[model samples]
Target: MTVNPLVLIAILLTTFTCRAERLFIGILEADSIQSIHYGAAAFSRISDLPLVQEQVQARLAQALLLPAYAGIAASETLKIVQSVDSDAPPAPDNPANVAIIPLTDDGTMIRQAFAAAYARHKSQDAFTLYEAPSDTNRAPCVAVAVADRHLFTSVSRPALTWAWQNRSKFLEAPAQSLPGTFRILVNPQRMADLTGARSAQAARIIDLGRLLRACEALSFSFTLEGAALAVTLRATAKQGSALDALLASWRVPSEPLWHAVPDNAFFMSLGAADRPDLWTPFLGAQRHRLLVPTSGRLPPPAVTGDRLDYVAPTRDGKGLCWVQLLPVKDPAAARAAIRMLADAGCTNAVTFSRLRRRQAGATAIETYTVTLQPPQMAQADKTPADPSLGHILLSLLLKRAVLECAVHNGHCVTVIGPEGAIDEHLPPETFAARPLPLNRRIGGQDPALTPDLSFGGFLCAADLVRHTVTIMPEIKPEQARLLPRGGDGATFGIVHNGRTLTASLRVQSNEIAALQRLNREGRAVLQEVFFQIFANQMMDSKRPAAQ
Candidate 1:
């Protein structure tokens, strides 16, 4: 008997009456896993690097969850149903996951396989249970059962029985055929609610709840052709929701500003804007804090055009610097905004002093120095100021902070760097002299890919690791272990095709290891950074007050 894929999907779409009961359904059509294998095998055969080939094999085997997965025949059709906790956030370490995998041959093959792996077996509550005592005590009592042509596994017997009993609810009469090789649909609102509850302050600060409320469902799909794998993530908007309105208003196409970025730049994010008001969605309220860092409430500069943001290493490759370019619609308004930012600096415990003015080709650049003032101490604790001491402290903290602002070719170009490393990558002339094509750099050049995507960015993985370790030497060893090496880069693009918004991540076959490593270590990297910052703050608090 053959099952209609759409019937299974319809069952997945059904709403549960219990608030705590959550379900996740995944459908893998025939040959899906085989295709992934084929891609990896083709890559391995073509790749010149032997280590990358070995890495692909190891990753594929681990993902399949069996040592001899390479020899296992691909299932004709695979349906996976898991029960999730709606109140709790999803996590990798969640041990409550119950999986129901459809089986072939009356489930006898899988039953025998489980029995061989476990030490005890018995029949209880109309379900055969197999127990595996974990050697490490991570899962002392694991359970597995084979019933109704499906294999169930879970740490909890209650969860297993619940899934077995409600298994019928996830299927119906035959209907339409499945569309993609692999697809998964999730309830975005439920996930959003859990996230909001967990991070109430952060959710409120960014209005994350409201923004995610418009998404009725979030979907992911994957397709592999030859050696290239394309993964797309899309959020289905609710009818008449705030996100619906926002998406409708986002009609501006991101312009091509890849040529503006220097080849040595480690990262780049470029987009286009028709007017200043449209930037709110991309920048949000945090733009002011990032761009100006002033305590004033003055409006942002009136600018509208293509945006080019890039980060590159300093001349000696010891430090990193950033540059931002925005189209200058009104130079006078831009100047006034800068002045307001400078004037508001004093209120924010910082000072902005004009250093000098110089000519860089046809553009006139005005440079400034931003210095962070030391905290004040009580009168009794105050001591005579030592000029050398203050100078050393400032140099160590600010590292010769420099900011250069210029308007060239109808764009407000701002470059911020340390140690006077700002003159090498000046806008217009320098960029024109050495233009870096983004598509060529990342191997993402495709004529079919829309040139006017809503947003696009690139990350040079090797450069990122180098620059990150260079900046924070304390984490060099740990970062080396966490980050992937020997990959060119990865590219991400987002497209809004009138009705739906789709974000895609594309990478070359050689960079597969890097992508996998990044996925595994990305969270660890963030945690390490936060821990370092907290440690530094605690040390500073313990230090004696500067005189």
Candidate 2:
């Protein structure tokens, strides 16, 4: 056959340019969180490892931090760290040492808050944000912003506990105070996702009312300007017997958004904890609920190793809590454990936590607690039985605070330990003969799998990064594409350089002999420790040199 009218007008202009590129298609903009700045510098090099500082002091000694403060992530994250203080030096350039409290009051969001605090420290000399300085040898300090005059409190900010700034390293930003300079308060307030309106329609009439009557959960504390604010409600269950059976079938005003539910007053569930005189403001009545190890290399603050989403109180356990400690560094021993637990009259408190897993001297911890009773079914708040894990306890308290800065700066010590503790010695662990097939295994290597953590495996709320994430992305589909799984046998694998990425995985799974297995083997040992620390931090990129 010899067809050629210029090949029939080039096959009808490539079949109408592939049907106008499949009718104006879109959705390919997946990459470019600018790789979240190389995933926040590979989570600041796995939170400055020493086996992630004994898994961020064994998850602040076993409170098992709520999953990555709800940013969401989990392919592998097993922590409980702390073991680095041969001395202690690295954090100065002060202003009451790194404090940023902005739930809102306004000023145009504190002048756009140093452009998101300079895109979250792109030049990290560690601390500094005085501003208006073209550059005067940086760190120039002095800052403060103590406000909470309870703007007529109805839902103020008390127990919110923001991201420990972003795990750790603020040194000086919310500044102000004096004849000198250090004023960093970029206030703009309101952050439980904006509030009010009968507390957002009574938390959407008990989670879109159903057969459920008052399926409850609520926490409402007080005090402001003098700080201390808390508000929580995770599930209301069928708002008023389903608004009295939809107003007897048509009564009007049911529009809490076509009954889609979930406005639980914006959000407070993320494991609400800290009531009866609520106090979580930048935590430092004598700090160190855990986060010490100083510059052994700086690792401790994934907020207990990533996976905390926020909002709890399903049937009782309520929500909200933040305690990232590292204390024990005499302040007369935490003011004598707060004046001997405040002369044994401590009031609202409960402790029995432990998350050390394998570090201090290697393998042996992960204890847990925070139990309180009541709420036979819901709405409990008389105070006590607080077991909230809202969003998997803020994603294991920010990945055990990014594994306590990767065990005081060595990074994951071949599996979590203070590895290069050198003459100070301690770090060690091998475990993992093979394990997985249960709920909470915080640090179990199958001695029949038991160290089992609890806040009840963070009340299995679900949404694990929208179904146990498997992205497998990478692009460049044009040239008139038709790509379908370019290659095969992919239980998992992906690539992309257009930036916009984030990977902090470590996943696990096993069941040998007869079958049932699918392991990522610590995502190939943290994707070769995140590409050898992203090619030595993009060849020490202060930027520019990559020709």
Candidate 3:
């Protein structure tokens, strides 16, 4: 056969061109997707749900233009593996349950899916893809044939390729850690760089650079062992001394105040370590005017230790009120300061009178009753008052209600609340003689989990669900329909472990199983319920000033 050299040359050139084009396009697409992921992660750190929603809506709009992309579909079951590594050995325990919906391999479909997953504000442009030269020395080389701003997909080609090539070793790789079900391994230095590139608007809202410097990595794991969810967080600092100083600043009392609260209390928060300076940030101009007058009267005795406990109405139909306990250095000084403020007319219509004294333990407790007059408003001032004003007014009223002070062991416990509620509702013995239910459940786990814990509380899930449904008639049917059966008796705790300042919701075994069994439809229903509750709470808490 006679062959033309020109024909052979043309064929060779065409093949080479196609291969080169694919590689160029792939690299561009990979970089674009990676950038988008980083941007999404940064937005999430801000904790602005509304802004996140806007972003999602914008992405969904773009996805709507793609014909191949359809709306999300329901799935019956979600598989949860320990790691993305294909050849890794099976976990010794039950795998964690996570909500995930995989996408098709088509470029267009993948891009649409990514958009759906990471909806961003309309103002934020979709990532632009452009061809770039590849570094031959880099392992797991990524290649592509075409670039599509709307159709390109795959968040990180390098990561995916690395995982595939080192399937068995990926989980144990030193570069990355995969110790938990929901793991986030962040390079602090890289995070700092990303934060620097963020918009001025975002930077002004949060100190992302400082935040990233405090934490090296975070992991969340749900295990059947003791039927609980555990969170492990790692902190990082440029120097060991800096890390130590950071932890020291957060140190709280060796013991928690929850033990002193009644078991029936519905909600409670106790701070073991007191830093009055921390409240300075929350003291806005209006609050400063109301609480801090020129008279130099000290603010409510620095609650060296404090407790705010609440209880819901009982079956017998008795409404419950919150009781706050503050330990001070000197009760007399605190009393004098309040009296001076009232005399200076800084307080709104306040009156104080002494009450009976009693003996408890090795201490003699003195009591006082304070009354506050309601704000006198003009008929035309019907416009809703500012939420900040309401809060200030409430604080003033509570300060004058009924206060009991008992000094022992170099500290004074100043209890404040309605006299009737305190006398009738508070148990004779404030401290628990035996281990509380939550303490029993937590067992011998590190005391560090509770000592410096900012907030720690436990509740019966079924009871909470029942009460919520009963109080909010509109959500009753939905709650009843969505809540899994047989998990009623399960208990859950919202704990903020002090050491790492990480929060987690720990659910019992039955509830965990129920959560795992939820199909896509069930999950959606639950999510809707959660969304509604969150929306309602946000609305209720909205400040007039913010509006």
Compare the candidates by lDDT and give the number of the best one. 1
As a TM-score, model 3 comes out at 0.43
Give the per-residue lDDT digits (tens) of candidate 2, residues 1-547. Answer: 2221223223323332343211110000101222222333333343232243344334222232111122212221211111111123212210012222222343234424433333222222322223332334322232212232100100101111111222221211111111010111110011121222334454422321221222222111111111101111112223344322322221111111111112221111111111211222212233222222121222223122211122222222121222122212232322223222212221222222323333444322222232222213335655423234332333332222222112222112111112121212112222123333122232232111122221112222122221112211221223112211111110111111111111111112111100111122223433543355445444533457457
Score every model by TM-score.
0.65, 0.17, 0.43
Give RMSD to native, each candidate. 8.2, 31.7, 16.7
lDDT of 1 by residue, 467-517 (tens): 555476556665656555646566777666554566667655556655555
Off by over 4 Å in 3: 1-179, 188-210, 216-232, 237-246, 250-258, 274-317, 337-419, 425-430, 436-440, 443-455, 459-503, 508-547
Cα-based lDDT for every prediction: 0.55, 0.22, 0.38
Pairs with backbone N, CA or C atoms under 3 Å apart (clashes), candidate 3: 22-144, 22-145, 26-144, 55-119, 55-120, 55-121, 56-119, 56-120, 370-400
Ordered list by TM-score, greatest first: 1, 3, 2
Between 1 and 3, whose lDDT is larger?
A: 1
In model 2, which runs have C-alpha deviations exceeding 4 angstroms? Answer: 1-369, 376-547
